[model samples]
Every structure is written in C-alpha cells, then in structure tokens.
Target: KKTVTFFLVVLLAVSLFTQNDMVSAEIKPKERSVGKKCLEITCTMTYTTQQCSTHCIQMGYATGDCLPKEAAKPQPPEYCCCYFEK
Candidate 1:
C-alpha cells in the first residue's frame, strides 16, 4: 500500500510540472513580421511600426503600374515628421 501511495504522489507531481510548462509555452511572445507594408496614410504620421509597414505594401501595389520592380520608394511625407515634432 505504501509503495502505491509513493508512486501516485510522484505521478501527480510530474503531471503538474508538465502542465505548467505547457502554459508557459502558450504565453510566449509571438514573432512579428519585419518590413511589412503600411496601408493607412494617417498611420505614417502616427509613427506606428505596423501601420507604416502596411502603408508601404499598399503603395507598392498601387504604383507598381508606373514604376519598375525596384523603383517605387515608400517615402513618408515631411508633414508626417512635423506632426510628431510637437
């Protein structure tokens, strides 16, 4: 009976530790995609990394008609910098 009790206690402890590790893994930070396109024009002034990225992508798509493969530059307006200077 004592041996059975010892085994049960060990099993429970191992199960608890494994569950904790699984929970921690789920909580880990997700990887962000770098150099993603920016969609919103206002987002440029806002200076949010994700927004700017989306805008760049949209611009690339729209202007792809005019420019060659590498010619289109995702240039944020000077006013965008002005907005943040204050």
Candidate 2:
C-alpha cells in the first residue's frame, strides 16, 4: 500500500509538471515587424549585439531581432525570432 501510494504520488507529480510545461510551451508572445526585407545572410552575434547583414528590406520589420521567429525560436515576445520575407 505504501509503495502504491508513493507511485501514485510520483505519477501525479510527473503529470502535473508535464501539464505545466505544456501550458507554458503553448503560450506565446506577440510579434512585431521592423518593416523591411533582408538579404539571406548568416548573422554574427557579439557580446553587445547580434545582427544580420541583409538589407532588412521587408515591408514589416520585426520589432526585435528578425531572426528567431515565433514558429522558429519558440520563445516569448521580447525577441523576434521570426521575420517577414520580401
């Protein structure tokens, strides 16, 4: 009985954690555009900043970095992992 109870508790904990993770993962922040299209180029990230060489010519530039889009990066809104193509 003790073993069964312990197992049940562990199962419950795992299920709860998994549910929380799923909920957090599903939640996403909004995306803003910078208004430009950019050339396809590999960008470098320095301690100070990470930037791409492309012209960023898309009509709608992302509010933040145009690299990691929501679909691509999977992070919250502060940074823009997505970009609008020309």
Candidate 3:
C-alpha cells in the first residue's frame, strides 16, 4: 500500500512540473482591415491608431492598390500606424 501511494504521488508531481512549459504569457498584435485589399498600409503620426486611420480612409477602396514591396514605411512613425490590405 505504501509503495502504491508513493508511485501515485510521484506521478502527480511529475505531471504538474511538465505542464509549466506548455503555459504561455505573451500578447499578440491586432490586425485591422483598411479597404478591400488583403495587404495593409501603416502610417505614423500624432498618437493612437485612430488618428492614422483617417489618412487611410482618404485613399480608401477607390485606390486600394497594394503598395510596391520596396516602398518605404509610412510617415509620422511615432504612432497612429494603420494597415491596409494589398
């Protein structure tokens, strides 16, 4: 009986220790749609993504052209980064 109790206790301890590696603690970035494309555009300006969104809307679906792969990153870079689909 004592041997069985020891084995059960050992098994429980091993399972608990093994589970810690599977747990995670990281945040994921959010992706938002710009117009009708699958690619995205990012703008930097002022603060908050909301501000950048205004700029994105101006060139909206009417010109949902995907930027060249070699195009530079958006301006204002500090914040207000918006994404559009390609």
Candidate 4:
C-alpha cells in the first residue's frame, strides 16, 4: 500500500513536469521578437553566434542567434532563432 502510494506520487510529479514543458514550449513572437517576426530553425550541429547570423541572412532574415529551447530540460536541442520584419 505504501509502495503504491509512492509510485502514484512519482507519476503525478512526472506528468506535471512534462505538462509544464509543453506549455512553455509555445513561442510568443511578440514578447521574444520585439518588433520583428521570428522563425525557429532546427540546429543539428554546433553553431557560433556569427555563423547563426550569417545563416539567417542567407535565409533572408534580418538577424538571428543560436538559442536553446525555452524552458526545456535534459539537454534540449538548440535552434537558430531568426528575426525578420513583420
């Protein structure tokens, strides 16, 4: 009985954490982009800030940065977040 209760509590905690990650994964363009629109490009390799900016320019965005996934845990993938005129 005690074991079952402990297991249920652990499961609940895990579920709550996963739900929070899902919520925070949503992109808020206005808050993060300032006056511009933003795009997230999946980054498979390590990228420097300059490289990310250059890549964004090549893709026709005004600017960009290599940023980690927002509110993520356990080594989230990085992304090249590019900004452009709205």
Using all chains and alpha carbons, the TM-scores for the candidates as numbered come to: 0.42, 0.37, 0.31, 0.41
Question: Please, what are the lDDT tens digits per residue for candidate 3 over residues 1-86?
Answer: 99999999999999887776445322444575553332344433333345445554674533332233333763332332335554
Clashing pairs in 1: 37-53, 37-54, 37-57, 38-53, 38-54, 38-55, 38-56, 39-54, 39-55
TM-score of 1: 0.42
What is the Cα-based TM-score of model 4?
0.41
**Root-mean-square deviation of candidate 1:** 10.8
Badly placed stretches (over 4 Å) of model 3 are 25-86
Error of 2 at 46 (Å): 49
Model 3 clash pairs? 38-86, 39-84, 39-85, 39-86, 40-84, 41-84, 44-76, 44-77
Estimate, for each residue in 1-86, the C-alpha lDDT of model 2 and write its tens digit.
Answer: 99999999999999999999998978965565344333334334441114432233242444224342334565432222324533
Off by over 4 Å in 1: 37-86
2 or 4, greater by lDDT: 4
In each prediction, how many residue pairs overlap at the backbone (N, C-alpha, C within less than 3 A)?
Answer: 9, 18, 8, 0
Measured over all alpha carbons after superposition, the RMSD of each candidate to the real structure, in angstroms, is 10.8, 14.1, 9.6, 17.0
Tell me the tens digit of each residue's lDDT in model 1 across 18-74: 999999999998875433222223433355544444444455432211111222664
Candidate 4 off by > 4 Å: 1-46, 71-75
